[model samples]
Target: MVLERFDAIVFDWDGTLLDSTAAIAGAIRGAAADLGLPDPGPERAAQV
Candidate 1:
């Protein structure tokens, strides 16, 4: 009962244990800034 590609399963779909939206949004903003592009802002970043 083990998969070679994965070590564990995640069960945080409801954001009770973890919330990756902010982190992902920050990364997107950082990437855009790195490329000399305007920031999409927190609202746009989190939504789109």
Candidate 2:
């Protein structure tokens, strides 16, 4: 089979082009800590 190409590609922000994983995870961990829960760590955001 052959491959195809597109004239251009589009992506959404807040995830597609940014590695906000650390920021997101930090927020989650902070929230969890505030609520007396365990910090899931930045890797958890990457999984999501």
On lDDT, the candidate that comes out on top is: 1
Taken over the whole model, the C-alpha lDDT of each candidate is: 0.87, 0.78
Q: Residue by residue across 3-48, what tens digits does model 2's lDDT show?
A: 9999998778666778677777778888889999877777874565
Which candidate number has the best TM-score?
A: 1
The candidate 2 region of ten consecutive residues with least summed lDDT is: 39-48
Report how far off residue 41 is in candidate 2 (Å): 2.3
Q: Give the per-residue lDDT digits (tens) of candidate 1, residues 1-48.
A: 974887788786746877888998999999999999999998899985
The TM-score of predicted model 2 comes to 0.53
Clashing pairs in 1: none
lDDT for 21 (candidate 1) = 85
- TM-scores for all candidates: the values are 0.63, 0.53
Quality of model 2 by C-alpha lDDT: 0.78
Candidate 1 regions off by >4 Å? 1-16
